[model samples]
Target chain A: MKTEAFVFDAYGTLYDVQSVSKITCEKFPRHGELITQVWRLKQLEYTWLRSLMNSYRSFWDITEESLIYTLDAVGVESDAATRAQIMDKYLHLDPHPDCHSALDALAGVPLAILSNGNQGILDTLVENTGLDRKLEATISVDKVGIFKPHAAAYELVEERLNVKPENVVFVSSNAFDACAAKNFGFRVAWIERVTRKAMNREVDEAEHVGPSTMFKLLRMQMEDLGMEPDYRLTSLNELVALR
Target chain B: MKTEAFVFDAYGTLYDVQSVSKITCEKFPRHGELITQVWRLKQLEYTWLRSLMNSYRSFWDITEESLIYTLDAVGVESDAATRAQIMDKYLHLDPHPDCHSALDALAGVPLAILSNGNQGILDTLVENTGLDRKLEATISVDKVGIFKPHAAAYELVEERLNVKPENVVFVSSNAFDACAAKNFGFRVAWIERVTRKAMNREVDEAEHVGPSTMFKLLRMQMEDLGMEPDYRLTSLNELVALR
Candidate 1:
């Protein structure tokens, strides 16, 4: 596929979502992992719920709200100072190790972030990680007042980059986002960073079970929903090969 | 607040979603609870995912798809006969202990179910549970080609009952659905059956911390998203008092 531009999901694909785990683990050694897991799950749920309700809030606010809910759920004391401290950590989240090198290799492609983050927060995220100089556009779905997996959110890439959906290579660590982008007509790739084995084994098992029949059934299901990811990679390092 | 019509959410509110736990436990003694929990979570997720993808599959299909995914995730062998047997359990799911008496007490009001279930499955479910004689309208969103919390799904109640939204009382055990119904202009009651104390305590603690100011803030957050549930009751029996 000759891709004209590459649009990436910001939070998990490029920036490691669990970067706060180090500080969090130090603060509450026992519940750090649970907090991180709950926070991220609530963050995603809030976005989808807000979208379905047609109530749009910036990702920053949703992040904070999710934090409060997480703290309450985990039976932690919600001290204001600790809350502000964690919120600050979000602003300075470190990028994944593969992020810079991959972006450097695909330097010629018009790159942008099509994120749920509001314009200001995403702008800071790009600049804080020195991705400001590397990326061509820092696109926010705030312009359309919705979140990812929504067609309009994906449309921002084409709108900002002035490229057709068919020409864009959209990448996300979130399988659902990648599937949504594919449904929106983008050639998509899912970065299977954590459960790489699970993804590979499912395909392999399907193939081994009944020749192409099982594989065909799986593919047909994805095709039926326009959710078939064009590629699955363990890291962004693999994107260089696609180029 | 005179309720001219009573519209209930079927699953989790009227019918116990965990009714299959008994049989499922006998089959998979070690992993039954995990399977049930995962199955319910994935079922809700598939609904939201499918809605966003603009690919509407009936609730029956989504239920089965979630079950398949849950079984695979748990590394259980997917047996065709076992799958069909569990699905059969769904059709004859027992109503909660409070369901019958509550429905009987409110016998004069027009009662209906606003659900995601397709007509056939819901029809069988209602009839199998003897809810057919009790409920005036067994409405399915299948007619609208969408699912619950969608404004259109709630609109069917007003249309069929020949009543205004203000005259309808929408009751659900699902927090999200209760909130959605409130947003849709119904007098909504949330049946806080399982986690009643937790929900009440959160609001109470928030209030105790800073007078009604904290309560106001908490309510405002819910109000902002149209998620404010007007009444929170521990049981359907309490619903009778609302009359």
Candidate 2:
């Protein structure tokens, strides 16, 4: 397809969620899990709710809102001290082990990190990972609150990177992030990592049987692209090396 | 609100996503992440896509389809043996630590697991987690392929649990799942836990935001129930201890 540039999704893909999580998670050993639980849950909810309502906010502001709601829900006193700590940590999250190497490998081509996050958050993320040196573009929808899959977000990358969605290799650990890029016609890659997902089961209440998740959407896209997954799976480093 | 019973959202709320993920992730390290990534991405996409396209399949089958496509995308081969291995694992997932104990605490109540999963898959999950042993009902939307947020799936729970929407306290870790339950007039509880959420980074994504998340949806619900978070956190034992 003559792909020239690789566009990456921020958060889980480039940076380790655990790394950012460690910021607040390490503080309150008691409420650490709950805090992250609230932050992520609300962060996602904020995005979806914004989309459905057609409202928009930068990921940073929403992150704050999520934090606020999380605190309130958990009955934690919403003090400036706690807020500052979280924001500071969030702003300087560490990069995934594979991030720098991957960015370094794709050094020559135009590479971008297109996120629903604001420019500030994106920059901080890249800078924290120290991979900012390699990026050709750092795109974010600062003016809009709309997230990915909305077309507008990807359009920013399209405009900034100046590459056909079809010719750009978009990567993310998030399935929906990839879906947005794929739907936009970008050649997307999902960097799936084994996260230490919590094992707290408050209630195995009603289980979900929704449609295939975003991750599955990529599968459908791969079939259309004639891409085949290797039965022999390898670590991200190895896979990236082979690629 | 004269609530009759509380129905919970299963997958993200009560049960861990790993149940289905381990099916593939264990066999293929990256495959687990890829499977979860794809499955989640596609599942959410399918819901929105089908909602937009006006066609639907049971969440279970959709899960399978997404798996096939994801396997192909990542270049992972899902032969009969591999597929069965992954598929069978769904029937034997280990419950989260808090699952059994909480189920034990809520034993006397008319608790149920409502999902859009296939009858067989849900049945198998129930057996695997030994969840059925603690609950009064296990509801599935097999008769209707339309998943959560769809009235039909909710109806399955309502019909089986014999609880009116308001009378029933619906618990789910999924924001959309909780929102839908609330929309259906059920008293919903967003289970607070640490789980990766599928997002496109939109602010409005909050529509589906589960109450229990980085913040603590459970705490929010507890507030609704006139209960306080007063240091009541952790496993079922600790939670009940507060009570």
Candidate 3:
């Protein structure tokens, strides 16, 4: 019944992955959005595919690989400048508006980030977002050579925190990540941000899939697999109430 | 390389899953296309998700479950009569025009189907489409309790046919399946039917993912992981040339 520590997913949960859209749209006005959509999906897919294949790649490498594929697939010219700009955008992803206050409210609780990002990327992201002071530890799945949804990724928390899996309250904006953590025996809190709808719907709309079918599939997968998130909320700020 | 047997993926490769459109259009009238796209994606997603979760469900149940979700998500009503009609459509999927001639040409070589379909559904599909006589065996993953892309599912071929994986020339229209078969040590022939382009693009266009980014990702995954299909052809009729 008692929670010992809070674990967070970095991309799309604490930080806005599409914050790069401004420069992306400026660089390639017509294809920027599709580039973002494809880039993000490929980033995650590469992780699972690698894990399933028993091959390993750092998240940083996967991010660049996916970005290259996105640029080619969307017919964007990926010059050196454009590549550098986008990669920097990833390094300096802006935290969600609620991030600071939510963590501030839960300052008494030990906080950590469990991310697919390599250690260097997580350190840069944390410092760039001014989250260094608030976070007790930042654990990267790079140590395990596999990505999230793999039980080994979750085990990093147990190893680092020295706490039982039951005592960890993992929070993620992604349903699959939350479901994976739940399957790994963590009490999960799913942060359902409002902007998440726009991202899901716009990507689905652009991909020509149904309005909400992608997100719906994620939820359905979680439900069908019997790994429902312990709690869902519109904002991470709601976590303060739990504390 | 001597291919002693040609093993096929039943659903999308041999049987046209979209053949259900005739009756679906009659019933839904307005949302038939979107329903088909969403239904197929959800069906495959369920299998992958279940495999990742290590929970298995019969493809029949997964097919029905995806249909129910598709109907509800797309705002179509799913009455008992409607459900029965759509489910019946799956049992009577039409095989591609090339299926007969291709198998006929390869009459000297043993032909079999290795599918995610449960035994009953595979039997019904084969019997309904008159493929029973042509197929030497219909191998279902039901006995293994897993779906395609999993090693265990592909093992069904070896177990049923008593052929080494290398001696079986595995064919799948789905790139992920092709990649998995390749990884499992089968010399794979990927059937690149023209309509596959429209289906991949439409689904991507509808799901708003990309023109063919999903398939592209599968190919990329295979390449990045060092598993590549040995051969690719435009039609099943091309199989005759292989001999």
Candidate 4:
């Protein structure tokens, strides 16, 4: 299949969201991993909740709010300076190791990011990771005032790139985003970073699974939503062969 | 304040959803607690997801799908019969210990249930728990083709009870439901079953927090969604004094 533009979901697809755990660990010591997992989950939850309630907030605002909730819920106390330091990590999340190599492989292919992140942070994040040099545009859900898996958020890709959904290979590591993109008629590539078999083996072997394992068991697996992605790739490197 | 009707959320408010853990433990052995927590969380996620996607499915369908997903993710194998047996528990979830007394306390006042459950299941579950005698109506989001946290779902209360939002006391132990109900203009009474102070104490006291504790941390607290419930009560019994 010939793809027009490789439109990607920025957070999990291109960048390493778990990279935030580094700063979290430094600041809160043992609670880093827990906070990281809960923060991301709540951040996504806030988007869906707001979208359903017809109350739209910027992804940045949602990120901070979810962080506060996570810290409070995790029983960690943090002042403004510490919180700001933690929040600042979003604008500089490390890109996945395979990101640059995969982008380089698809050199001539038109590339852009469609993210739930606001435009300012999306632009800053891409630039910080040196990914901006490789991409054409960084699209944010802020344009549509709703987060994906909403159809309107997906429409931003077509409006910005002048490419139809069928022509664009929308790639996301997030199961919900991938399913929603496909449901919106995009040729979706879901990055299956963690396989079900691997997860099952871990659960079977480990006597006691931690919060991170539980998070994976709950959120990382593919959703049972009727829509499924067109392609299930193990990593961004696989995107090159598809194109 | 004069309340026109007292509308309660079915799953976590009037009923104890964790009661299903008894059956899940019987079926899955050691993995029952994990499955029960994951299943409930995913069940609620599916409703919000479907609502946001404009892909409305009955709560019963969502419940089954989430269970299937949870079993697979947890690496436990189950046949249709076992699955059906487990699903059967929803219809007979134990009402909270305080449920009947709270209903009895407000005998002269109008009482109803506005739930994400479908009409048939809602009716069946209420009757099974013997809450049918006390509840004047069991309102379902199925009628609205969307789940709670959506404005349309809350409108069903007014349509069915003919009570204005201001005069209605929407009681929910589910934080999202309570917040959304309040956002929808009801005088929401959030049953603070698991307080943040208690959650923090648990986190501080425990060396390793379990999935149930994490579930409470992630979900049981009031959301920072810019809408706060009108009243915060420790138990459903406290709901009596409000009237």
Flag the better candidate by DockQ, 3 or 4: 4
> Tens-digit lDDT track for model 2 on A1-243?
676777777776676554545666566644555467546645765665455434466787778877776655555555788688877777776677777776777666787787777887788767766767888888886655567656767778768877777777677666555545665676666554422121011111213311122212232133322222221211234334333
Per-residue alpha-carbon lDDT of candidate 3 for residues B1-243, written as tens digits (9 for 90 to 100)? 788899999887898887877887888876666667657766776676666666678999888877886666555557988898899988999998888888999998999999999999899989999999999999999998877777888888888899999999999887678877998899899876644345334434543553234433323222333467888887899987666
True contacts kept of each: 0.09, 0.12, 0.05, 0.71
Tell me model 2's lDDT, rounded to 2 decimals: 0.57
Winner on lDDT between 2 and 3 is 3
Interface RMSD of each: 12.9, 12.5, 6.0, 1.0
Stretches of candidate 4 off by over 4 Å are none
The C-alpha stretches of model 2 lying farther than 4 A from their native spots are A72-78, A195-243, B1-243
**Which has the greatest TM-score?**
4
Q: Candidate 1: which docking quality band?
A: incorrect
- For candidate 1, lDDT tens digit of each residue in B1-243? 678988999988899887877767767765565457556656776777777667789999999887887666545675888888887888999899999999999898888898888999999999999999999998898898777666778888888888788888889987778888988899988886645245435534541222122211222123224368888887898877777
RMSD of 3: 4.1
Per-candidate RMSD, Å: 7.6, 11.7, 4.1, 0.9
Best by lDDT: 4
10 residues in a row with least lDDT, candidate 2 chain B: B195-204
